[model samples]
Target: MGAVAKKELKQYFHSPVAYVCIGVLMALFGFFYTQVLISGSSSNISYVYSNMFVWCMLVIPILTMRTLSEERRNKTDQALLTAPVSTMGIAGGKFVGAFSIYGLAMTMSLIPAVVLSFVGKPNWGMIFGEYLGALFFGMAMTAIGIFVSSLTENPVIAAIGSLGIAIFLMVIDSVSSAVNNPVLSKVVSWISFSTRYQQFTSGTFDISSVVFFLSVTVAMLFLTSRRLESRRWN
Candidate 1:
């Protein structure tokens, strides 16, 4: 798993994907942070984090688009599958590699908050919770992208598919409202990413939200592994 992850990371950096994704994320973060500072709206860094929700939907897909898709396209997936590693290991390693790139961008985004501290004190606990929420959100999105990548050898298609899924999750609550069945609507609402993310911006560590994000991440990764496992038999 570690070897796979290391290889994925190396691939990410060796190409322009890692640099482009990280640059875009940090640039967006800087833009939002600057707006917050100028507006004097809220001292809490959660403001920037909250505003970044939609931007992440764009960035994460690009980050994970090539994880598995590129391997299949280059006919390297067969070699990896026949290796001594389990499908789960490959999926997990891919997830880690993609998420690590995202994590680095998120970490660098903290520099703005650090600079803000010189001017005024921000709520550190709230910032922490927001960061945690963003990380979990990124994890789930990365897993979804990986699963999408597994379905197609084309990275462009994988990216579009992942972005579509992210957009769907964002508007799922609105879609649910159009449905008449109470139980079904309630069930659909349970997977609303924006709702779960909003809970963390309030500075309260909600266990349920954490669980929801992790469950999504795990389920997507499991599905990705299963997809690979099926390919192995074929």
Candidate 2:
């Protein structure tokens, strides 16, 4: 696991792709933060966060598109499959690589909060909670992207697949809200990934929200491992 993790992390930083992804995300965040600042909003990042999720729809696919798909495309996966490494190790390595960069992205996101602090005493607790929520949600999104990357050799297809799933989850909040049946809508809201993100901006710090993000991440990573294992038989 350590070896795979090292190799994966190296691949992430050594290649120009990882830096490009990070650059794009930071640039987009800068753009959006400017929008927020210029709009003269107060005590409400819910709007920013809601739109930020849409940005993920574009950025996540870039980071995840090549994860496993590139290996298969280049036939490098043959070595990984035959290696003594467990399927879990391979998946774990990839997740760690992606998650590490995501952590970087999240930490970078704090720059605005720090700046805003000097501008006026922003709600530190709420901002921290929002960053926490963004980190967890980013993990889930990357896991889902890795899962899709496992299914195809085409990087473009993997990216498109990841984008579709991320966008679907993002829209579910609205879907739940629009539904007619109250009970069904309530249940749907529970499942709607974006809905869980609301607690952060609202400063709820709900444990259930954290659990839901982690749960999705675990389930998706497990599926990714199984998918890789299936390639052994193929």
Candidate 3:
């Protein structure tokens, strides 16, 4: 699995996709960081990572859009399919590759936080919780992207399809809150990215949310593996 993951990681770095994804994420973070934070006013990140919801909505697709699709499109999947590896191995490799890219982007974004800590007493607790939430969010998004990638041979289609679903989840907060129906709103709110993750940024680490994210990530990966198996029959 390590060897397979390494190969997948290498492919990501070899192509321009990884670089483009990280660059776009960082650039957007910088742009949004300024808009969300005004100088000399609290100097906090209440809205910065909060606004990351939008970035995740669109970027997860870009990062995962090519995972399996490129292989199918190039017919390189034949080698993988015929290899002695299991379906879980293939899905795991792709998930690790996507997760690594997301991790790299998150690490790069930390430069600003490191810089800010020296000048003021930054909320380390909140930062830690925020990254935790981000990790879960990114993992779940990657899982979704991996599944999308398995569905099509076109990277463009994979990205767009994943993006559509991600965007829907991103705004579930507003939708659920506005509907004013207790039962339906509660269900939607529970599924909302902001609602599920709000406790993290609010300086409280909730185990249930963490577990939920992991469950979703695992479920998507499991589904992706099943899909790959089904494709062999088709």
Q: Estimate each model's TM-score.
A: 0.95, 0.91, 0.93
* Tens-place lDDT digits, model 3, residues 116-214: 665565676777788788888888889989998999999999999998898888787787777778999888867777788787878788898888889
Per-residue accuracy of model 1 over 147-173 as CA lDDT, tens digit each: 999999999999999999999988898
lDDT of each: 0.90, 0.82, 0.82
| Best-fitting candidate, scored by lDDT | 1
User: Considering summed lDDT, which 10 consecutive residues are worst modelled in model 1?
Assistant: 38-47
Q: Pairing residues by index, what is the TM-score of model 1? A: 0.95
Pull out the clashing pairs in model 3: none
Q: Candidates ranked by lDDT, best first? A: 1, 3, 2
Evaluated at residue 217, the lDDT of candidate 1 is: 94
| Model 2 Cα lDDT, one tens digit per residue, 1-234 | 788778888998999878987887788777776676776663554555557766855687788888899999999999999999899889988988888887798788778756755655666777788778888888888899999999999999999998888778877767767878899888877877778887777888889988998998899989989998898778
Supply the global lDDT for candidate 3: 0.82
User: Which stretches of model 2 miss by more than 4 angstroms?
Assistant: 39-47
